[model samples]
Target: MDFFSRQESARRATARMLVYMVVTVLLLFAAVNLVLYGCLWLVGHHALSRSVWWWHQWTPQAILGTFLLVAGGSLLEWFRLRDGGRTVAEMMGAIPVDYATRDLAERQLLNITEEMAIASGLPVPSVHVMKQESGINAFVAGLIPEKTVLVVTRGALDHLNRDELQGVVAHEFSHILNGDTRLNMRLLAALSGILAIGQLGGFLMRSLTGGYDGRQTRNPVTIVWIFGLALWLVGWLGLLQGRLIKAAVSREREILADASGLQFTRNPEGLAGALWKIREQGSWLSGLHAEEISHLCFGESLNMQRWLATHPPIDERIEALYPGYLARMRQRQKNPRPAAPTAPTPPSWNPEGTLGFASTTGRFAAPDKPLFASPSPDEPIPFDGVFSSGGLVGRIGELRMEDLESATWLHRQLPVEVTRALQTGTGAKAVLYALIARFQPMEPARLRALLADRASFASWVEQVGGQMQSLDARFALPVVELCLPRLALSDAGEVTGLLAELNVLAMDNDHLSVFEFALLKRVEQHLRPKPPLMQRHALESRLQPVAVLLHSLLAFSSHDEAAIARHHHQLMSELCPSPPAIPDHGLPPLEALDKALHQLRSLNPDGKRRLLDLCARAVESDGILHIREYELLRVIAGLLDCPVPLLQGVIHE
Candidate 1:
């Protein structure tokens, strides 16, 4: 299937999730109404016949009971969120990511991720290695686009070579792209709510049992028996509801995900090989927490009971892929096709071919030698610009008028030297601008400088851009970012490393200013996503005001204080509805921010900490937590990760 077909499939998956949610909501509503009506009938049947007071007198009590049921359900959802992280952590910890007292299997995990990202047109996800298990298993978790985590068992990494690992990553990426992750998370939340009903019934039963005494058991004990019987029935009903949801929907989701994974990779052998290895090494995941994630595993994580199995039998799955393989196994038949005797057919295009010849063709004319030596100026940047207007062509119409209009705006008058300058801080702005501009042309002077700096062609873009009239800066930036993630890391150690690099770079030019440092922080923020709780509009709004302040500090203070305030306020309001009112000090524009920053910097050792704290407070100005706000807070926190908050000791310069 093409990209659009797969996207349509994902849409169908989303529709399925919505349908499940609606059904769940309807069932819960009906069940609660039935329970309420039954309770009201028991209490009001005699009262209605007497008519001593209004039969409507019992309405308030009935309403309260219904409210309690709904509140109980809401509480369950809250409880799951509170408990989810710990539960997942404890399960993961059971199978440690350490082999022979090592810190983490970082290299193998990273290699797999890099290969997978290369294969799939997606961002490389965060990688986690679980070392205790020798079983080949993997799983992915996260709700949003940014926070997805891809976890692999140590056995899979150590046992499977690079190709097999690539296969596994491809499978996980398929789950992410196909919209299964979101559906699975929703199911978890809904199931948690349904299960809470059983817990409530159990709680009531325990309380009643504890309150009963010896004398109460004898006289009119039938009421107590009936009450106990009702509680038992209700608890069982709740349990059954939870199980039915899991069995009916949750189990089938795995099969769909597996099929989707196969469709994405377009190579059944990748998965089949991994599965075959699992069987060879004994497919038992040796971890205490295996049961928690059993349903999400590539293979069975736990010993399956025939009735409660989430996944179909592995043999059946293999048979589905390799038809008649099971029959061959049963009959002990020999393979019809001989292995390794014939060479595989090659693709039509060969990379080694000359310019005029096709990629796969071996024949090349001698006249095309000069063309190969000095290729034409307009060469396509392959596997680049996959996210921009050029990449979106397949999804929408190819080269539409609106797309051209937008691409024209992206056209920059960048110098070719800007590519080389991107390696250092000197030409970062020009390169960044050029990158955002799709149709940018290089100036003559910039091209000459790039030709002179041929020795510093650190990456493919620099080398190619040096000779070309125009280059795909959009593609090059992401490639550089992916290849050099330390350029992206905002951890304390990483910050220190960057500071050292800056120190060396500024040896001849003297000290780096606060403005430069702030710019670097901004760039880093753009590269990484913030934590869920901190991602908010308030934080993004805070960026515009802060950006303006930084520009002013860099000797560009043309706008008045009122203008600045209006811009800041406008940004904040855009980010959050009903933004917190800003108090007017009637001072110069950005004076408050300048003062706070100066005070923060003068603290020397604690300067970074103060800045982070200030940023956190600024991000929460709207009094509501958002994901963007969380991300901004995290970026600032990373800039100051070194210093811990002190107790009695005041931080003075």
Candidate 2:
């Protein structure tokens, strides 16, 4: 399935699971109420008869009370997990991986994660290691990409080779990209609700039996005793249902993730080998909350019955990846051979700095230089290019294998200091400061005045600003994205201070460039604690506002006023048959544009898709994609939750 389909499927599964959970809760409610009524009949009326009239035992108050109790408990549990994936990680006692660690295994993990982040065009997720866990397992957790966390067990790091580790990390990335993380959170919430009743029951039973004290109860036939017994029975049943629900929801997802992982790495042997190691060794976790997040794990963390297993059997999973795995194992046993050592290969670079395909000769080679010619400003834009709104949606979380390889090459090509700076909080601040200072031409006196009191910060910016400015502008946004996960490690106060400094620098000249707008917008979106909620808006009612937003976008795309006007007319005509007049004012200021985009976010998916199509037209109207325009488009698409893939024939020059 495509990205949208996978997302839709996850939504459907969540809905179906919710329905099942509600039914289970109702059943439990009835069971609890019936038990209460029975106890009342026996204790209050002195009747032990099983065939007593059912109507006499039934009470509206009892039914309502039980229903409220169950529903309330479930909601409470759901609220407890509102912090999402980070909460789950903490529950497992996972520690954040230090990016500066010199450990080879840790460095390899960070490198693989960086490459994947670049390839997927998503922010690098926070990485954590389960120090006490000896399981060959890993998992990604987060309701959304910005807050996501990827966790690996120490055993996974120790047992898996680089390729095998890539396969494992890729599997977890599939979860993050496929919208499975949100679904997993829902599952965790629902199960906790169901188990809450059992926990209450256990507490009540313990109180009645004097289990909490050093004495035993004298009377076992009291109403409290009978109710406690009923609750105990109900609680255990809930536990059973919780496991069954997890098994039903998670097993199929595991298979799909395995397939996606293979698609990402194009290395079935690596994944298949990991599975082999799991079968021969083990993937079991000894953590406290292992059972709670078993379904979120890459491999089954608990040994469960077949019907209750969160993952398919290890053997079955291996066989699915390699159809004749059992036969291969027998052959290997009979004629074991040492694996050959492979030589490392360098990345291929083209003379024009464009990426080119390298031959599979285990050695890098330079490509022949091609004649370079710049397109004229008057060149006609290709209106007939293959552009699919649906195809764009499908590319949201999907990455080609070639992109991954390119990302790997790109990571190696980056300056070592720049890479190091992105890995820590202080360095991340320096990078951002340098990027902002060099984003546009700023008067030296004005900049110095703006930083008059902050000597240390100003010095750092001056030190790095030259290097940052000399680098290609196209890489600025990507580098900033790489720094976000680490920057997130800063305390709330530190982030607030950094954001304040950023805003000051952005507004120093009283005008925000397209690059500055895009940079600040993307950074704020990640750092801000509360994200804007998506709401539905009527396209017909909001057409003028959207047009004004599009006008601003077009104005930034080209310097030619006539060209901008033509592009605006073209897009308006396409969106509305009877085109509305362009706003009387010139290009809206950055603040106005920000407000317009915020309002446009409430447009329904179809409306957003149409807006993006108009955006593509505007960007292409100039017959060339400028770096600033490209960055703006990306920021807009990201805000709409409709990511566009890198366009063809668009160089970042």
Candidate 3:
């Protein structure tokens, strides 16, 4: 399935999750009422079957209370999870890998994760190791890609080689890109209420049993006992339902993830070898919460009934990756063939030909070539401000090996000092400041002013300023991506200062450029509280905001107003029965456009794809995506919770 299909599947799983919770709530309500009626009868009020007074008076209260209890419990658990992936990582007994970790295995793990992240247009997620678990397994968790964490058992590090480890890490990245982590988070929250109910029942049984005295209504001991029994039963059933849902929705995804990860590495053995190791060594975890998060693992975390298993059996998964793979492996063991070489970046790799996009996708050949060739950073990135009337159009969804190699290669071109700087929290903050200073040099006075007041930031900017001056424009985004993990390590006040300074530097200019807005937005995505999970919003209702955004993109990049209007006409013609009036007042300012982008965040996943298609066709008519347009489009896609790695393979400095 494509991105839209993945989104629809997530929505379907969410619907099932809600349904399960509703049924559990209703069952609990009935159980509570039944216990009440039985107690009243035992206390000599009225016959249980004939009781109308209590039922009429308390039924509404009982349902209301049950709903509140479930909601309150869910809210509490959500607050606990506010830190996103970090919170979940801690629960799994994972210790974060230091950015400057000395161990070779941990360092390799960090490098592989970083390459895959940049290659896929993802934030470099924090890496953690489950030191206590010896299982050959790993999984990703978070509310969004920025806050996402990658957790691997110590066994994975010990048993897997570089390629095997990369295969496993790529599989986890697939979850972040596919929107599975958010789904897992939602499911975790939904199940919390049932878990709380079960725990409460267990606690009550233990606490009140001694007061029973063998009397039916002895100080309400009998009533508490019945209520606890019913709750325990409901909790048991809720747990059963959770497992069934996990099996139904989660099992099929394992195959897709395996295929997607292999596509990235293009080494079937790399992934298959990982699976072979798992089959022989097993992926079962000894963590206390293993059973609860089995659905989120790279392999099944528990040895359970076949029907309730969270992942497909290891043999079946290996077979999917390479049919009749056991014999191939046995033969290989006898012959002992060498591990495969990493794939090279194809000379012809471009947005048009790679990732299933039409051969004439956007541009004729090398993307970002001009920017890379510029002798110095003083020359600003180029923008033709011209679009094809016919629009660049084609089907696109998958990643190619060139994407990973090219992204990694481009990142490696960065000066070694800059990369080293990114390994520390203070240095990462300085890198952000240095990027702003270099790219928006016109606003250096304001930047200096903002940093001068904050002593720590001031020193950081001074330290990195020299090396970053020669940094290629193409590496700006990559460096920003690398800075995230380190920034994540910064203290709260320091990060807040960094963000505030960014705003101070950017806002001094009356109207921000699309580039500046995107630059700020990218950093803020990780530094700020994560955006809420995607919720469905109809295109019809969101047209105005979408138009506001489209207008900014069309007007800013195009010198011809007529071309802008024509493209807007095409977008509206496709969207509405009768087109709405275009803004005669000209493109909305950046602040208004920023608001418009935020408002459109609620667009359904399918709607997001459609809107993006409309937007791209409107501006990308030349079959080539220039750097300016790519910057604009990439940021917009990021806000929509979509991946825009199309330009990742473009050769750059």
Top model number, lDDT: 2
Report the number of clashing residue pairs per model: 19, 0, 5
Full candidate order by lDDT, most accurate first: 2, 3, 1
Output the lDDT of residue 136, model 2. 90
* Residue ranges of candidate 3 with Cα displaced over 4 Å: 23-72, 211-234, 330-397, 442-450, 453-463, 490-493, 507-513, 533-536, 576-589, 622-624, 646-653
Deviating ranges (above 4 Å) for candidate 2: 41-62, 210-222, 322-326, 340-391, 442-449, 529-534, 538-541, 560-562, 585-589, 645-649
Top candidate by TM-score: 2
Residue-level lDDT of model 3, residues 1-653, one tens digit each, is 67667656676777876886777677767765665565566576645556563474457766776677678777887888878889988999999998766565676677778878776777789999999998899999898778889999888988887667878998888777667888888777766765666666777787776354546436667568766776676667667867876787787667778887887778777788889988878899998899778999998899989998988888888888878787887787799867643221112222221211111112213345532343333344322332233111121234567666666566546665566676688778778778767777744455667667577667667667766777666677777778888887767887787788777766666556565677788888877755675357987778788777777777665778788788777778777887776654444467767788888888876677777777676555433455556777777777777766635423212
Reference-based lDDT, each prediction: 0.43, 0.73, 0.71
Q: Which ten residues in a row have the lowest lDDT in candidate 2?
A: 363-372
**Which residue pairs of candidate 2 clash?**
none
Q: Ranking under TM-score, best-scoring first? A: 2, 3, 1
**How big is the positional error of residue 632 in model 3, measured in Å on the Cα after superposition?**
0.9
Please give the distance, in angstroms, between residue 444's alpha carbon in candidate 2 and its true position after superposition: 6.7
**Model 2 lDDT on a 0 to 1 scale:** 0.73
TM-score of each: 0.49, 0.87, 0.81
> On residues 1-653, what C-alpha lDDT tens digit does candidate 2 reach at each position?
87656767787879888888988887777777677767766555554354343333455665676666667776886777676577778889999888766556676787788778777777688888998988798888876777888999988888887677788888988887677888998788778778776777777777765222236543443567667777888888888888888898898889989999988888777788788888877889998788889999988898888889999998888888878876797698799898533221112333333223232332223323211123454563442442334344455667767667656655555554566566578878877877878777665566667888977766766666756656656567777877788788777898788888888888787777888888788787777634435457766657777778777778776778787777788778866788777676455456667877777877765676667767766766655566677787778887776554444334435
